[model samples]
Target: MYKISICVISFVFLFFLSVSLFTFSMNFLLNELTYFIEWEVVTLNSSSIVMTFLFDWISLMFMSFVLLISSLVIYYSKEYMAEDYNINRFIMLVLMFIMSMMLLIISPNLISILLGWDGLGLVSYCLVIYFQNVKSYNAGMLTALSNRIGDVALLLAIAWMLNYGGWNFIFYLELMKNDFDMMVIGALVMLAAMTKSAQIPFSSWLPAAMAAPTPVSALVHSSTLVTAGVYLLIRFNCLLENTWLGQFLLLFSGLTMFMAGLGANYEFDLKKIIALSTLSQLGLMMSILSMGFYKLAFFHLLTHALFKALLFMCAGAIIHNMKNSQDIRNMGNLVLQMPLTASCLNLANLALCGMPFLAGFYSKDLILEIVSLSYLNMFSFFLYFFSTGLTVCYSLRLVYYLMTGDFNSSSFMPLNDEGFVMLKGMMGLVIMAIIGGSILSWLIFPVPDMICLPSELKLLTLFVCLLGGISGYLISNVSLMFENKALNYYSMSNFIGTMWFLPIISTLGVINYPLKSGMMILKSFDQGWSEYFGGQMLYNSLKMNSSYNQLFQNNNLKIYLMSFIFWLIILTSLLII
Candidate 1:
């Protein structure tokens, strides 16, 4: 046991070290790879293929977040899963997930990209059901099934692209210039991304996935599985450039952001509240990315990873101290007991709410600026604005619920802080959440000219941050005054909570209603046809034919052989004809 523990520890440290090195050397790696410039060597069947260096500014930005979040989540979970029965299996799955995500980030072809995508989905199922509970099992199954539907769509799109575009490889740089069936392929890819990212109509699986441990939720939701879709879409931004499909993606993303934010506000379970908020933030990120602001989207993805993981880990620490109860209403005055955890939580929440000077402020405000700059249509701008408001509301509610309520002494377990390993992981992410945006802007973009935000836009961003935080505070305070009974009157909120059923019912109605009516008409036609054909007589002949039964009896071998020969001859004649 001791040896196994040491080996696992050593492996984790090595993996994290490699990731950090990779992130720092990303530009050099891309430059070196690009210098070689051999696109002809790699071929699919007889088709010539172009393989470009994928470690571009955008890919490197996402890779940094992926490595940072994934490493921290793994580190935190080492202590988080200390007492679990299947610790080795858990660690194995985590490593595989990280490796697959790395491969996904650097993939140069569509087939290779799908390989990583599917691998992440596969391991996600294992992590989700690691607890081996009925709920976890069911949630994992649903998530897998939903993701498989998206995978099928993706595969179909790949086939369609190959057939129409005559491009056997799905290299973004090559496919960018191709015009044939780009719309169809783009729409299918969007559908695939929507499901993977847990956008509306497919978002329930994520909330259900809260059955997993906090670290798994933090890793999968914050950095890996959900982000894959955004990464895919952004990696192929040229395909989405100036298209109606792009507009559709932007609108859908806006709708998901608003709906998910509302859901997060209504939720009380600690992990789930955070889960839904992550979904909302991802939705906002998708909206930004879909609008052709790849840099802004990458920035938001970076900030969101740091803060969301920190938030989940902090919530996990709280849950650990509270004897595994995740109900925030049952939590209060925790700031007084768990100062370190509370401080981290507050920092993360501040970033999430887009308070000025925090990482989220820089990234999210950039997205808001892009939305304001959008001259495409009024509907897109209004949707983005409304969604941004809800984002503020829910983020504020999360902090208020955990920290400000009256103390519930009954819910408090002995004040036990998380292990040093876990705290170390959370603290690292907290620091990143504070400084990531500035560092990224300095490292990746061209000096002063590449800084996308104008001075006026920068000031507008600060103003929006201030306005959002103040409004969120006011709403949180007012919300405390309402009794739990007041919630019952909010019919719209109830409908939204049960909104998963809406799509299911609509689908069944579309499929079943017409089929039922058609079946009734078909039954009538069948009855009429049977009457015309002496159906009763035929039925009676089959039912009471002693000769027919005798013909099939074991004692009547010659008769059976003759009947088989006649049928074979008829089938052969039909085939020949």
Candidate 2:
């Protein structure tokens, strides 16, 4: 036992050290390689297949964001899983996950991208089921199965591109530059991305994934698995431009955002609420990306990683201290007990709610600005507005419920702060949530001529934040509306929280009609053939032999003779014919 414990500890330490080293190496290479390479392309086959390594603005920015978030999640997980008996297994899976994400981000070919993409899905299944409980096992199965469907779509898209466009394994530029059927490939890829990103119908798997531990949730939500779909869409942006598929994606993203935001507001479980919020935020990011604001989407992804990871880590701390109770109603006045955690939580909450000068303000405000300028129709505008309001409501509700409520006896415990390793991990994320925007704006985007915002829009956003915070607090503390509701009405909230199912039902309806008709036609043909040719039952009886059955039952010598004779007669008949 002692030896096993030592091995686990050493393995975990080495795993994290390796991730850090890889991150450092990537950063160094980014600097040195930029000086040597301007543009280079190498053809791999006669079919116009090629690979290009050009460090463009968009790719570099996304690559840096993914690497940074991945490293931080690793740091958080090291401490978050410190006490688990299977710490070594967890660390191994996390390292593998990071490797896959890194490969996907920097991959220059669709083949390499698919390799990393499928790798992420596989590792995520293992991580989700690390506990080996029945619930975790079921959740893992569901997530894996749903992701496989998406993978099939993506593979089909790739095959379509290679066959029709005569392009294979090349960079996205070459794929887009080809004069192929963009609409067909775009629709297929968009469908694949929607499922992977948990948009609308596919969003069910994300909340189910809350059966995993909080650290896993943070990694999946903020940095690794869920972002794969967004990456795919961004990579194929040119193909998607000026297509009906792009419009459908925009509409689907808007609906997902609205539903997920409402669900987040109604849920009381800390992790579930965060999971739903992650879905909503991902939807908002996708919506902006579809609008040609790729930079804005990338910025939101970065800020969200910082704040969402901080919030999840803090929630983990709270849950750990409370002996694993995840119910928000059971928690109150925790700020008095764990000041360090409360402070970090508050900072993250403020950032998520888009408080002025915070990281979320810069990213989310950019998205809103883009929406305003995009000339969307009324339906799109209404959906975006409602989702924004719900985002504010749920983010503030989490803040108030976790940090400041009436002191509940059930929520109190004789607990000390978590270790330095945990706090340090969370503090790094908190700092990013504070200053990430300024760094990205000044160094990355370098848009000094463009003003940050109009004074009117800035005031409106700030006012919305203040109003949401105040309203959420009042509803939680002063109002009797929720308390007085009947059991049936309370169940209605649960139904609303599961609204991701609506899209699933719609998708099923769309698929089932043709499927059912095809099955009926096949059945009719089978029946007609049976009536005309004595059916499968009669055919089976004609081939049956009493001797053969006896041989199977008793291993008798007579059976072998009969079998040989039957084969000889059949061979003779064939020769005569």
The TM-score obtained by model 2 is 0.78
Work out the TM-score per prediction. 0.80, 0.78
Q: After superposition, how far is residue 497 of candidate 2 from its true place, in Å?
A: 1.4
lDDT for every model? Answer: 0.74, 0.73
lDDT of 1 by residue, 1-577 (tens): 7524743574467457656655655666446433223356577888766644355545555666676677677777777777777777777787788888877787656666777889988998988888889988978987888788788888887787775554334454444545657667777878888889987778777787888888888888788888888887876666666777677778788778877776666667888878878878888888887777776777687778878888889988788778788887888777777788999999998888777678887777666776666665777776666666666766776677677766675842587564787898898888888887666656544354434656775566555545665776776676557635585636645666544353354346447989998888777666566654678668778777876676577566787789899999999999999
Quote the lDDT for 495 in model 2: 74
Over 135-224, each residue of candidate 2 has an lDDT whose tens digit, in order, gives 899789878877888889878877876755443333345445445555666677788889889997788788878888887787788867
Q: Name model 2 segments beyond 4 Å from true.
A: 1-57, 164-180, 409-412, 449-458, 478-480, 500-577
lDDT (C-alpha) at residue 462 in model 2 = 56
Which residue runs does candidate 1 get wrong by more than 4 Å?
2-26, 29-53, 164-178, 409-412, 449-488, 498-577
